[model samples]
Target: MRSSVDIETIFATMAVGLVAVASILMTSAPLGAQDGSRSRPVSLGADDRAAALESVQFALAELGDGASYVWHRGHGKLSGVVQPTQSFVDGKGRVCRHVVVLLSAGEKSRKTEAIACRLENGVWRFDS
Candidate 1:
């Protein structure tokens, strides 16, 4: 049989434990908001949007970094016309959706295609 004092002490310990957990969680909440660098979007879930947008972003990242012609623009948020012939394969085995981007500069409308080199390390380079 426990005395009233024992029950009260138990409840107090439980309450203190709960407060400690809550404090830790509150402190970590901001960390979750930030990436390791504390800059830019974190969350792998955030990195991946819906299928269409994700594919577009992956493609643009390839174009900007891999393609010598077109620097990585992170332009997936914008709209662009992609020719059907566009295709990309990373170095390792990942295949990226290729895009035939049309660069219009004044009188010159130059067309160039970009592909993702399937690098095993997930580093995108210029592919066919």
Candidate 2:
């Protein structure tokens, strides 16, 4: 079994990684940019967004790097995949993970990359 220290270390690493992802999301241009033209951000209905967030939270909480979780709802109108690409410790010592979320509805799809970190209450949330 892993010791408490080991677990803490792992969480710290994840936090750092998540912080980096948040930074990137804040500063970088939107994803899917091509030819210097910005693309419209993917839009999801409230319910679909919530559903996708659940999958993202689950993936960041339970899956390791490169692992993916698929989520679908709304009679298949809403579907997507969540994957964590990396993990690290944030400056505030929170555990974080860099995640990729793809949300699709019918023929339209939006891809988002963000960082997720555990709050003090032990719940995971996307950092900004």
Candidate 3:
């Protein structure tokens, strides 16, 4: 013999629980399956680049030059080898590192020369 108020309260609680479960399922889904969008760029600071360079260098030292290694950041996976060419200051007054990374993924492969510059927030971004 529950009152009408009790029935309303039970229905409201059930609705909230269902909504919470739906939200959790939605968020837990894989990023790639959610939409038809590509993986976004990941910000690597100077320190991060330096660390990555060290890892690359070590891999190169062990595997020899032109060796390919897999680099994973965020949702993106890049198989490449980083070869440091030089360093220079950009027009924006940021110190940039010039490097050639030979990237290969599946049947696609390309050699890209990129300049990574440090931003004001200490994050390194690709200038070109």
Q: Candidate 2 residues 32-87, lDDT tens each?
A: 33235455533334455456556666788889899989877856656778798999
Can you tell me which runs of candidate 2 are displaced by over 4 Å?
Answer: 1-46
Ranking by TM-score: 2, 3, 1
Model 3, poorest ten-residue lDDT window? 16-25
Instruction: Tell me how many residue pairs clash in candidate 1.
Output: 12
lDDT of each: 0.33, 0.58, 0.40
Question: Top model by TM-score, which number?
Answer: 2
Model 1 Cα shift for residue 105 (angstroms): 0.7
| TM-score of model number 1 | 0.28
lDDT of 3 by residue, 1-110 (tens): 11112222322343222112112112223223334457433222333334444544444334333444556434243344556456678787887665455433333334
- Quote the positional error of residue 101 for candidate 3 in Å: 1.6
- List runs of model 3 lying over 4 Å from the truth: 1-78
**How many clashes (backbone N, Cα, C below 3 Å) per candidate?**
12, 16, 0
Candidate no. 2 TM-score? 0.62
